[model samples]
Target: MGSGISKARRGLLYISYNGKVQKFMFDRKATSRDIQEQLAISCGLTRLSNVILKCRGDVIAISPSMPNNTPQEPYTLEQAGYNVSANDIIASTVKEIGKQFRQAFMVEETKREVYNRVASIESRVEKDGKRLMEMEKYKLDLVELRDAIYNKQTNTLDYNRLRPAITLPNHFYCPSTEQESLISMARDIPAYNKYVLTNETKEALKTPQFDVWQWEPNEMLILLEEMYFELGLVDELDIHPATLKRFLLRVQENYRNNPFHNFRHCFCVTQMMYVLIHGCRLQEVLSKRDICVLLTACICHDLDHPGFNNTYQINSRSELAVRYNDMSPLENHHCAVSFKILSSPECNIFANLTPEEFKEVRGDMIILILATDMARHAEILDAFKQKLDNFDYSSEDHLNTLKMILIKACDISNECRPIQVSEGWVECLMEEYFHQSDQEKKECLPVAPFMDRDRVTKPTAQIGFIKYVLLPLFEALNKLYPEVEFIALESLKQALNHYERMKDFDENKKKLFAGPVMSKSGRDWYSEKQMVDEGGQ
Candidate 1:
């Protein structure tokens, strides 16, 4: 029992030589002398007790009775004869560790692959959505192009003769592509091509062919195509391809003569309609369908006008005016003629519309066409302003917004059109008005404003018309459509400038007519007159 070794008030040691086991119990406080005394007796090293005590805390102290056997040597845990080295141990552990790390890396790689695959799928879905949107946009563009072409062809058609045929290709086509294709196809129709080429030459030459050349059906179609292609791009309004082709054919049959409602006028109106729709941002107010209907109305609003106003027809007691009771007589006749043509099974451009949609479209068409009467312009604008002021735009019912803006925009579209286009229209209208004036003069009837045949130019009347009528109407429209303000302002400015220039002309004329020769020196003339008066007396 290692001489019952004990450390003074610090620790106690117990050694069992029989079992080769040792036990130690530490004290909370012990001195170095206690450990020296215990080790000296327990290890039987009295002579080297001091040396053993010096190494005490450095090495684990064992009682001599607990460790009297030979020192045990360490052996490899693996098969000893197999000659396993420290490097082998390290290599084996590294391989196991590497295997775990590789497994973890594989899991991370798999997760990354899955994540990448999901991302690829999401990207594809986004691309597909964009492609679908683009396809829909193209379809709409195609529809609009088709409608424009149809309206142009229809207005050019001669109603008295055979109806012009407009063949629409079924395949998807862009306007530019279709135009190029049509130009190529034109070559096959030799007579049609010759007529178009000749007409083109005449226009280029600025020849007076209006009264001389009769408009052929194919020639009319070609012109329609040209006008349809010329209008700027519009996104919202979409005209059905079939409807457009059929409408053109019907128009050709309905207005065969070079009537007052010619294709050129329709083209101008259609172009104006596009400007109004886009320039006003009317899409914010109106539906795409409503816009389409409005455009259609613009094209056919003055159809079969007979180159005369209601007043003329009423004064002449024309059958059509009499039949319609002389109230918007020309407009009424035009609407009836257009709707009648539309009612025909073969001429129904709006055939594809549902009953409700058709009703709305027909109603909108009637409203717009009737509103085009210059006499109604003031009343219509008043009503439009009242609606604009009273109506709440935030209301859930967007229909009112649609009606108000569409009607207002159409009524004043001419004021916002390009200067060149507006000027062209003014000239055409002036020519028409003058022609009516001439007829009225021959009949000994009262001439109205521009319709006065005796008037040299009626520039004052022109200025008055723009200042009082056109400017006010456009100013109201500009409030609703700010983008068109610049255009309308420019147009008004140009018109007013022209009026001022014309007024100056009138002033200069007065000065020329009232020459200095007409008046002698004031005092000298009076003196000469006095002598003649005295002689007479």
Candidate 2:
């Protein structure tokens, strides 16, 4: 073959055989059949009929225009997109099988196997493409639904006026007699060792002014139990007091020792929710079941907080972010931990609920807990605001939105407390912020401006948070429930003013201390020091 083909006609081809690749020379005008005949002869085959040719793992027939059994003109190297002059090696494989019956059968079976694998891969790709299309369609459907309800272009909500008013379900009502007995039963149930609920403590627990720092851990646990009992949740939900206590203990234990997002903070939020539920007269507006959901959601909202915010979790690419796909990672972990504790039969406070009831409560609790994520703060607040003017206690949509706002209100109600209490919480929050900022520095991640210790002061931090974020929320709540003005809104305003004064004092103090310094020469100390300094010499 080398003597027959001229140097210009010689072309390089790489053939893979028996798990090894070898180079071979062929004529540029040689067809695949001629190359196969040469390879068969080199392999000691008596006839070319015994050799099967494959290119790039696919079987290549001897003839291009017809079957191998038929006689027709075959494609040359150039016709197959191979440039021999450019030394482009055409990758081919030679699967040698004798003309024996078993060898031919095996070759045919191998071809079927390759075809089957290709078909399988194609099927999977098709299925995955279909699923992606379906997901895209579902996302578009939600967008369409949102536009139908509220058209952003016109700033109009067409569905707002279309919703018919609804009435509270009969089961949602709490009987006065039953509630009184339930309170008595809850109070009478001994919760902790040597801890008694005195009149002062009971009264304090009823108000948002209840100081979590004042009570011992055991005392706080008892108080948490009392709130659930006092709200008639234990009796109405048929939760055994021991079961409720176990659940409370589990919740308290799950909360890590973070600076601000700790068990004490959890207690504070739950107590605030309790105060809101009573002070706002929400029980008359909502059902007993709804109250239960509110209190429970507050208790489990910050469970297992790691002292780090969601931003850090996402930016760090933590295990939590991977597990929850980077959407509200910490919040999602909180929900997971909450349900995990509830999964234990001994700590299952809602065990008495039917499957349907449990499912609804579980869903509501997740929604409320997830709502506490600050990323969704604006969305939740705006939704509540839109529903506020025509707020209906009977409408489920309106009621759930209110429940969301209620939990959110309680969650951040620390500033709405007495100045002393709110100030203490501010310190705790700043500590947590600084801790996270330090970690961000160590990890070389972007630090939040408000969290940067070098950039923030107590007064500067509280001013914007209260003015922009806290005030509008509380003021809006005050419109629907006038009691909020007395309970929390006033306190928030006072807190804002107190911080502003402190800010002013800080500025003046800076100016006072920043005055021209006097020296022994009665000149500016900085100027005198510079004169005497070595650099001045």
Candidate 3:
């Protein structure tokens, strides 16, 4: 063996096996198999012959030790590249072993806690997935119910049970073929084609014609297009031209072919609204809210008019009068019917507006349109007249009253047109009144004033209307907008002068009177316009 060193000196080797530690006893004389035999007895896992033992990563050799005392030979475990001593068991004590065991126990405890936390998270995710599936099913049920309520593909609405919220059933706008054709005509108007729009369009609006019977539908559409583009409404409102056309056409079709309160009359009122806003520079005085209200009210004010006055509806006990409790029946009907059209997505020109924006438009539009009832004419005129000197533009009520006057002025703007236009509209109005008279006669109801064809002639009727209705309204409007006042005064004076001359020509006295041709339609066309044929002779 070795010279001075004892080969039988023992040392404790702490072996790390799997996730555990064990202490093995070894001597300088022990071979690798000797360590394996210890491992087999302790762990029952080292019975294999191929097992090798290592201390601190270097292999322990089984061969004979180095012959005694070479000066370079390893003399201790430290010199042999292992930090071990004969007293290693005492230094690396049971206390150190207990600390390592506790550390291992804590690691296993941490792993179990982490696994349980992951399982809880997975359970929550599963519950959320089920809830999401339930919500999806509910949404599908709503869609199915909507589809069953209205068939958007068929372009048919269940009008009997229509709710405002589901106006067009999923916002689908489908125009009927006929409505589409009419809508096409609406887009053909001269949109900003200044050169294309005849001087008649500009002049008729400026010196406006009195007789509107000759004003055809094509001219009206062009004027509307001119107004829309001029106001930049197409861009500002994000309007689809075809959709606007559908709305306009729909409104037109709804207007009965009555002689005065007809589609042509609506066109006239709309045009006058355009003139008032643009010509009077009201476009500057009002906000976009005011402008939209005034313009839209003018277009829809006369919707579903029954060619009869409110009093007549009340007296005749008409359904409309009953529905509205006989107060402003026609005006209320107009507002209701117009909203019904607007409720349709195909005709809702204001669909692009937000709910709040639309609500504002709706409130103002109702106010402006309801002001057109002639029964409220005195109330409307007097209210504005009282507010003229102390008018506060910032005050909502004051501004609303002003807007009422504006829409009313547009309503009777026919009286402010040139002699022919004023005379023509009078004829249309008289014809409507006479038709109402006829209905009253058939129903055995008492005829209203100025509506009796037998009693109230055109000259007397128009003169009375101009003096009592147009004069008071326009005179008040003049104080607010002088530019508008000049034309209204001039046209009204001219029409009154003519009607004043013809006041003597009763039904029997007109046989001798001769007048100029009013239209190519012959005697009947000028029959109402032709006055004082016999002159002052």
Please count the clashing residue pairs in each candidate, in the order shown.
Answer: 6, 0, 10
Question: Model 3 — TM-score against the truth?
Answer: 0.57
Better of 1 and 3 by TM-score: 3
In terms of lDDT, which candidate is stronger, 2 or 3? 2
Clashes of 3: 10
The global C-alpha lDDT for each of the candidates, from Candidate 1 onward, is 0.55, 0.76, 0.69
Assess candidate 3 and give its lDDT. 0.69
Model 1 misplacement above 4 A: 1-240, 252-261, 393-421, 456-458, 520-537
lDDT of 1 by residue, 377-475 (tens): 666667667655555556633354345445545544443443444555555556667777888888877678666656646467667767887777767
Model 3 ranges with Cα > 4 A deviation:
1-215, 504-537
lDDT of 1: 0.55
> What is candidate 1's CA lDDT for residue 68?
26
Q: TM-score of every model?
A: 0.51, 0.62, 0.57
Q: Which candidate is the best by TM-score?
A: 2
- Report the error of model 1 at residue 61, Å: 74
Candidate 2 — which residues are off by over 4 angstroms? 1-193, 517-537
